[model samples]
Target: MRRRISVAETAPTQPGTTGSFTTGEWWRDAVIYQVYPRSFADGDGDGMGDLRGIEERLGYLSELGIDAVWLSPFYRSPQADGGYDVADYRDVDPLFGTLADFDRMLQTAHELGLKVIVDIVPNHTSSAHPWFVEALESPSGSPERARYLFRTGTGAAGELPPNNWSSVFGGSAWSRVNDASGEWYLHLFDTSQPDLNWRNPEVVDEFKSILAFWAERGVDGFRVDVAHGLIKHDELPDFEGITGEMLEGGGNRGPMWDQDDVHEIYRGWNEVLKAFDGDRMLVAEAWVAPAERLSRYVRADEMQQAFNFDFMTVGWNAGRMRDSIQSALATNRAVGATTTWVLSNHDVVRHASRFGLSDPSAWPKGISATDEQPDSALGVARARAATVVMLALPGSAYLYQGEELGLPEHTTLEAELRQDPNFWRTAGVDIGRDGCRVPLPWKGDAPGFGFGPSGSTWLPQPASYSELAADRQDGDPLSTLELYRRALLLRRELQLGRAELSFNASTGDTLDFTVAGVRVLANLGAEPVELPSHHEVLLVSDDAAVDAGQLNSNGSVWLR
Candidate 1:
């Protein structure tokens, strides 16, 4: 039942000629790897990951078989929200590298045959940004103020916030300014990040220029941060209920979150992307609800792809996962856009740890040492199985940097060392995203695990990281890193990304599907499932799980 398939011998049709594949549509089924600059690798020995770090590691990504690299924001910032609060859209943060360093990195990534997609935070900018500083100095009705959402307070003597909207991090979304204007600015995220008034033609044109600046520098695409939040209702209204985290998409979002007008902005952005020579693309980080509404962001004239948050947040159960997949595919098919699947990212808990939780759904905000601990061994097994299933699906896929190494979150990070604004803003109720953003361990015994020469990191690494370092797993056949290498190689060889998928008969606790003549069986039940007859195994999450004709619990296998 366990058989190794030769990737070199496979000659499946290329993705360029298959399902949803049109001429020059490389993004339709590309495998993009997300690099959190602060954690990927440290090249300057400055205790932080930088552009130089990314450039030096380009070969690692190339060998990993990813089609593109999606780097989180490295724009000039005060590090208010870990670079999400950008101070200057055109320049690189000194903490990351100079503009020249970014250009070099872009050139290197392109040379490696990997497209580059940089993060663009259009919804808000850091308070340190010149526009925001000028807006603060100008009077309430001044043109500088018009570029941002500055409004008079609502209460007697203008003491209360303009509306009842809450910040996604915590507290009121409105931040009062102590100045002659005495006006309050809106910020859906951290206080340092003031929301840009999309209604202002100046703001709209400025973002278009910013996009062109990067595209001209040869960045293949952009991942629009808070893509659904650029637009808001003209009448700033109060929410019907409490708004703890607006990014959690479901049901009907309130006025400030996912307004219908947001798509208009993207439609215009699409025009900008089309003007570029390369197939420059736009990917929405929108957390909009109902698969149908989410699809609207990826229409032919709009963005090409949007992160499938629904699939990432789905529980480990097979029934829910199956439903999520079916719904996503059907909606994207209607829009003629490729579906992008993601299981882990910089924001959420790594799937490696999430899968081991007693309540896997409870840790999106994050987990702490004081909280319920995950069963690490069990989590790794389930995560591997889940990845195999995700890789076999049609369309594009995103891999969080350390996921292939089975790196778990630093769940025990102490409070004093935490840096995410979510932790401070929420008054410690939310542990924040720091645990998942810890520096990567590259070597088993090297200082700082070869993350940097200085052997220091912004966030502390757990002792367990040493065992899972990349060097330790590099050539080990049974390692998670090798498994990913093999899986990605086979995925490309079989053209699974361009293959159509069909559901097969299976019990509630199991998922059975076929893609390009290859059958994928995932056993999420408590017991093993018998394999289908007359099929040779191509790959498996765990070799021990496949024996005779049975696949063990929380295991997955591919057959042909």
Candidate 2:
């Protein structure tokens, strides 16, 4: 019973062509898809995803109608925190593929007219990194030790940590070294990931070379990981305030986060991005907020875009959604930068499952198998509605892999199979993000859902995934995958990404707005709402939710 609409065909632009937009500004309203390499696909039957896996899927991404693909880190790493704990910034991990495999993937993506955005981790390095290894070998105050934050402990025998700061992954942020000096080092996340000293000139110069290294190889952009944590207070200070694994908004600023000096680092990085062709750009994965303050990171000469986490944190409420959208648009407008909208990423529980929870905002870390489960049916309906509203806004939209398939978090993942460090670090209390990062389902009946030739996956998929596999939904008009395809096609044809938003008259729990002369109506309340009269129905989030010109609860509709 799903409604379908015909969209006029338009010739596709060649790769590297920025059509209609100002030169080098394709990112302004681009729809970029986040690809977590480890969970996307496994090309070699090795029970792990690799560059060859992604290269094999370039055609799938192109067919998905995204403008660009932002790959999560696949660099050489111990993967203590996935690829965030990078050991070598310039090389691909053997667990992923060889350097040639990366080039081949990059080449294939470009040939498919998809821009490539690589993740850049600058705030820290794996303990096994050459710099960190040398720092451990060197004595206190040695030049090698200067590369990282290694300070003498405070107790009589230098036993206590230098400060009271806690790690994002739990435990003390400072870990005492076992060397002669018995010094302690800073690691904001994990013991294996050491925080680098941005005050060092060598660190700054090294990142510039790394940027140029990737830029020369034809990446269209870089998604700077932990973008706000690069520069810390010169004198590391104690922060007694409660800290979570991720910053939710602007109020959590402290010695280790959102420092003013961080802008200098990004400004220098912007200069490096400008030197490349094809409108090379940088997007910050900064969790800093108070939309106004977050604006500073996207100033003319800084990063082109920063993730708008505020929008994602706001629960399934019409007023809250409207406020977030308006605030993001107004703030970015002040800095002449376009806003970025994201519903879910690898670090958090998938939005589909979150929307199903009684208190949607309660479990950002994730849920365990024994935890209170969400209403799966309601979650998918609400997630579909939310995505429609997000896509209608005038900004760049980022889609996490499998979201278009309406994939929910693997909340039932067994504790024994969990690999997220947060789970172990918190002694299973935090549950961790492994549920959302489970390998994607591609084929319904194939081994590992066609993720690999072998019937093995790094993380097991739920039994329900077979029904939601790409092959099962490939040609089904009512399937979530098809819904995304149709929506994306309309988005490009209508130029919704470049449209301006204006709220229409609406009452409680119902959001009515217009973008580029198209009316978008979302019903968040339990009561059904009447659709705008005399307009052609362009799309609906749930087919059954719309009946007799009325949109039922947790449904959204587009009309022209």
Candidate 3:
């Protein structure tokens, strides 16, 4: 019974008035592909991905049907926190490439009709940054020390840390400087990364200049790192009931994160973006609480987008997913901003592995090799289904590198290869994120898998990766890469991103919705479920055969 509904059929085309993409507000519903430079490709065979690698891969991204590429930081650094500990905001790290290499990458991307968004870390700077170096040299209470959050310790001989706050990685957030004064400075992450004093006018001015420097070079936007943490409560006080759950964007509120004054900094950045010639944008990486608080970061006068962690971390339940979606959409709508949907990124476990767990309702802080492993077959199936559902939703989407190839987290990464500070600071108790950050496999049946001409990669590729390599899946109609490619192309053709989503029907076991004439259904229950009336089949997850309009359990599809 393949029932065709003519009323649901509509011509496939982009919604709204057509114009030069440059003149349009392209980011409104854009599909932005996130490129983790170190793992994407290796151009110079340095066993590390660099600007040249990204330049070479621009055509691949374009073919994947992405509107823009958001690159992780390649700024000069000690590599203390995988480029998050930025030492120089104005220069490229030699490990990644030179400024000339960056410019060429940007030029090639623009020529291919893709916008570029660079990561900007304003919340903290590497200890090697000139400002931090000068602050360390100056005595406590000096003007140089004022550039950062340096405070006097509270114990006898001032031995104890200034406050009881703990780092997101591990241990105390305040690190005692070894200068004669023996004062302490704040670092919410690694000690090699020192928090900047936003209260200081010099810190504010320096960041403004950093923004302009990149804007002049034609970057389309910025992804603000730790966007909610620049401001702190004036009185540095000890955290009383702070727990780990509260640290990673849970229902926690405190002095160090999601402060009111953070909005002001983004407002200032918004003005700078407005002054630019094109429709430049700013997206926040603020790991803030409850859906409502996340909305505050994207107010009309602030940043344009913030990662929807609520959607990303919610369990694989129909009821839970629907609730998260409704809440996110309603909240962002109040601020006149589009909701952003993301499943996984560089900092979290891949949703493929995450969904394979018995219960994926709440994301764990970290995954270790010794931990209970995921069901690989189940995980891959769910991941493919999830992609179709995500692309069918309203608002913008972010696709992490290697996800389109259906890669899973390398759960067995050796301790020696782990680089995330969370792993080192926690002393192997937490596996950190190196599993999801493994170098991508491109081709061949062995190590590196075409990541470089010399077959060398920073992180070892598993034997299992050979089947999932890009070259192997390039033309396979049933491959995850092709599924994403077709879904993305169809998303644009149907104008799904710009269309308003409506709940057509839903049940305890199944969730159904319609957007831009396409019906999206997800079967969360044990038994196969029947889809509503539609004119055509768009896509389906692994093994989900749409015979007689029935979608299999743990499967999803797009119709009409």
Tens-place lDDT per residue, model 2, 265-352, is: 9899999888887788899988786888889999999999999988988879888888888899999999899999999999989999
lDDT of 1: 0.87
Q: Can you write out model 3's per-residue Cα lDDT over 1-560, one digit (the tens) per residue? A: 46432211322233222112544778888999999999999899989998999999998888888999999999999998889998899999998999999999999999888899999999899999998899988887889999999998987889999889988888888898887898999998899999999999888888989999999999999999888888999997777744234555454467887788778788888888788987889998877878889899888888889988778877688887898888888888888899899998999999989888988564765567788788988888888888889999889999999999999889888889888999999897667988888889888575589897778888887777999999999867677887787778788778898899998669797878999888888887879887676357666655444556678788887777
TM-scores of the models, in the order given: 0.95, 0.95, 0.95
Query: Which is the winner by lDDT between candidate 1 and candidate 3?
Result: 1
What would the per-residue lDDT of candidate 1 be over residues 1-560, giving only the tens digit for each residue?
A: 46533322232222221111234878988999999999999988999999999999988888777888999999989998999999999999889999999999988887777889999999999999999999888888999999999999988878899999988888889989998767899998899999999999999899999999999889989999988888899999888755545344443377876788888899889999888987888999987778998998999999999989889888698988998899999999998989999999999899999999997555458899888889999899889999999999999999999999999988999899999999999889888999999999999898889999899898989999999999898867677887787778778778899889999987689999999999999999888788889987778887566766888888898899
Reference-based lDDT, each prediction: 0.87, 0.86, 0.84
Give the Å error, residue 320, model 3: 1.1
Model 1 TM = 0.95
Worst 10 residues of 3 by lDDT: 11-20
Candidate 3: where are CA atoms >4 Å away? 1-23, 247-252, 543-545
Question: Alpha-carbon error at 551 in model 3, in Å?
Answer: 0.8
Best prediction by lDDT: 1
Query: Model 2: how far is 16 from its true place, Å?
Result: 18
Off by over 4 Å in 2: 1-23, 245-251
- Models sorted by lDDT, best on top: 1, 2, 3
